[model samples]
Target: MAFTLTFALIAALAGPSVAESRDELEKKKNGVNSEITGAQQSYDESSKAAGDAAAVLQASQAQLADAQANLGSVRGQLVAAQALDAQMQAALAQSEADLAQAEADLAVGEQNVEASTKEVISFSVESLQSGDPGLRAFNDLMNGANPTEFTERKAISDTIADVQLDRLDTLDATRVILDLNEQKVQALRDQVQVERDAAAANLANITVLEQQAAAQEASVAQLVQANSANKAAADAAVAEDAALISALEADRARLEAEIQAEIARTTPPPATGGGGGGGGGGGGNASGKLSYPLDSVRLTSPYGYRIHPISGVRRMHDGQDFGSPCGTPIKAAADGTVISQYYNSGYGNRVILNNGVINGVNIVTTYNHMSRFAVSPGARVSRGQVIGYVGTTGASTGCHLHFMVLVNGSHTNPANWLP
Candidate 1:
């Protein structure tokens, strides 16, 4: 399991903050897409090697299947984790830089505030007429370490900046700016701590994964050599993994059903400018067709019946697995409301979008194996907006988008809708 560190903010931000968030999201999305492209090339090369390993293996079909299954996973998981580590490293660096800059800004702001306060105090002592408002205002500003007006900061700022009669107003404005700088510094410091902790955890996981990858890579040749004892070990490991996935999926399916029911119940009549039920029509912009959830789609697996990689059981795949590396930007397939965003041990981090009816078929889409989500559940997203980053989570062998679609409450091929 990868460390899908989702840092959620609790503030009920509005107005310009919303626009600022979107701009930041777009910038981060672009960065992830660029990094993922490079990482994807490396992951593909390892995948190709796995295929070539399978072709050359001279073993029983069962042995080959089981061994290929585990080896591919081991190799792919390592690469995916390494890519995630790289992204964490980049983020950690940026956070450190931000923290430094914020501290520097605060220091400068504090100096300016102190200087302005002293200048106002010294000059106003001589230049003031008796009972002047400027002298009284300066008295209030200096008397308290944090003025009682600090609680009424907005009112204080409006009075001072709008009705500037003297240098005292300039001093007052400097103090308000200083307070804002302090808040900014504290926020940056908190961000730095979080990134540092996540980076450390990621590095620890990668160390263990690297060892597993090396052992699995070596076992590929041993499995091909038809070692009976090693074969049993591989089978056991595969079975254990499959059982875990099965459990997670079972729980996810139950929860997902509840989520769908919740959406349907909350949805109002379409005649009243409300959306449809059963998976479609939460309604942002889905009208006629759907867009691909990923910018670059390399279909490693397709929707249909296929032999399961871990369990070797033939079952419906139910989604299109696009081979993207960790940190790849995942887009909304259509303008829709995010009805659900949650993590399953088997699905990793997933976002279910309730896209409006397309043509006549009510449509919904899901993006899975996410490193982190940009949009929260209930957010109305536009088509092609970045919603999350691709990651290797749950039962993933590597970083990819396991994109699924449902039409009117029935599982359907994503390819049928994606252009």
Candidate 2:
């Protein structure tokens, strides 16, 4: 019944949040939809570089999210405006129908009033010209000379008396009913006009809302465009990195065997009266210590399953991504020896550190996508020792470190192990 709708009402119709006048809201919504169509195409083509698109996508997502929010607010207003228009139109229709019925009843009542007046007029005219029939019947009954004649006259008088009162009552009732119907008809006409005016106003407001749907944007796309640099960097990193990605998928057993051997070595007995070489860290006993592989940890991606940005493949993401630029120092998480340092078309320059058992389990950590190695195999590095420099040499995008941790030689969540 309320004639006005506010931003809150629009939210109820569109969703549960946002605030703005209807026109501005509608315009932003249209802009949001268009922006998404364009952005999706860009994202798909950029993501084709072997999952590198995912790295830069985080960088580019802010603007697009804002656009969507603006659109959501506007979309709600349009629905609310349309709904109000419906209410106004329905009210106008009901008013018009009521007006028509009242007019029809008034017309019928007027005819009945006129007919009743004519019947009363006819009786008055007949009385003036031919005298009163009821009075004459009464006189005949009073002058009756025989008992049988008197009885017949009395019966005729009684009938005329009853008919006279009935005729007058009909005339009075008809006039009163006619007057009341006339008043109802006038009131209905006034209500119809009021509703008609309201409906017109509602329609005009809707037209304005529709026009505003073409609203312009000033700087919404700039945020998403800023991601180009990061996206390009990711592309170059993954160019031949599919080999590394495929190795992880198909050559898992071979890689694990080599790693297991390096971490299982015992310290050789002092080499026959010579300075001992670096001892291999065979992780088995608990030392109750672990640290972040990078000095600064900015987690970009967490350990879990995710759909490939472009391929839509469901796969487990086995490591945590730290936003470390290329050349950032990779450090040892615990006092342990290097498991291995190697390079291949599949795995870019990488190193694994065996941080001997902590919390009653053997812990091995790998730092991947490094620019170069800083430690030799079997080096007994202490906690926080530089092992390698972060790089995007492997199948990845952006300059970041892909750090992985294993418990008892099975890959586990790196976050669980890192400080």
Candidate 3:
């Protein structure tokens, strides 16, 4: 959020060392304006930084969300891989059991074949040893017993050889079955290994995604913190600027009040006699003229619109300036009451004398840039009475007297009333 300070320049207060002169008032107002401008610049910079931080935080949050989603997806894949691995392990176990059974059966079949072969060998040896070449066997075969017993004995020897051959054939078939079982077990083990590798790869991906999410979240937090601080600084600068403007306005109000009070005090009393020394209206003659306030009068500046020396802006020169040395006695123009004695920035040491109304005009004469005051407020004096001494006390370049004539609280040409 952005805020601007919109305040008017304040008038100078009526205080000692305050802007008692127009030059000083202008300088003071400009100073405050410069401060306001500086603060506004600072606020703008801070606001921009906060805006940038907000953008960064938003992007970081989006990245974090993406990372978190990826992590979740990878974790799911890992779980599936792990489940597949478990199933493969179970199958491998079953295949291994079948392979073990086939091995045991083959071992038993070999033992049976060995024992049968041994029995046949023993019988053959006995038969060979008992006869000379073929004599005993032939005699037994020809005259041992009845034909049925001989035939049975010869069948037993033939059956023994056939049985041995069958046992060998059975052993070969069992070996083939065991080899096939071992192949099945090896395939299952390979499948389990593949599933385990897949699971490991999935787990690694999940870990990487988790780390990315954490880093993105941390970046988001830092952005948020910086944004908060920037916003605070902007707010503080704006508030301070507002406070300064308010103070300036208050000072202006106080000065206005003082000016109004001075005006009220200088309002002249009702007219009475035409002219008299020590009375309210002095310096009036058959010609009806007011006395000169200064003896050595050199008009340094005139009344009316002119460019200000310091401000360089055209403004009303409300008073007339007289070139005079410091400590030059400034006398009253007429018999009047000193209604106001105060200090002003534009008019350093000032005195406002109220000369009673003459020719239906309420005459108020102001003397400015005085080095010192010889009289106090409410003092009554005749024409030519010294009220103050001339000096460059207020917003002036050199010693001089600034004289003004106010008719009914408004300024008028002093030349019209001067003799």
Top lDDT hit: 1
TM accuracy, model 3: 0.41
- Tens-digit per-residue lDDT, 285-378, candidate 1: 4346688888888999998767556534344576789998899899988776565577766567888676656677656677889999898754
Give the Cα lDDT of each candidate.
0.63, 0.59, 0.59
Tens-digit per-residue lDDT, 6-63, candidate 2: 2212332243222212222232222223222322332343345436455556647765
Better of 1 and 2 by lDDT: 1
- Better candidate by lDDT, 1 or 3: 1
Displacement of residue 11 (Cα, Å) in model 2 is 70
In each prediction, how many residue pairs overlap at the backbone (N, C-alpha, C within less than 3 A)? Answer: 1, 3, 8
lDDT, residue 243, candidate 3: 55
Q: For model 2, name the residue pairs that clash.
A: 25-74, 234-397, 244-346
Compute each candidate's TM-score over C-alphas.
Answer: 0.40, 0.36, 0.41
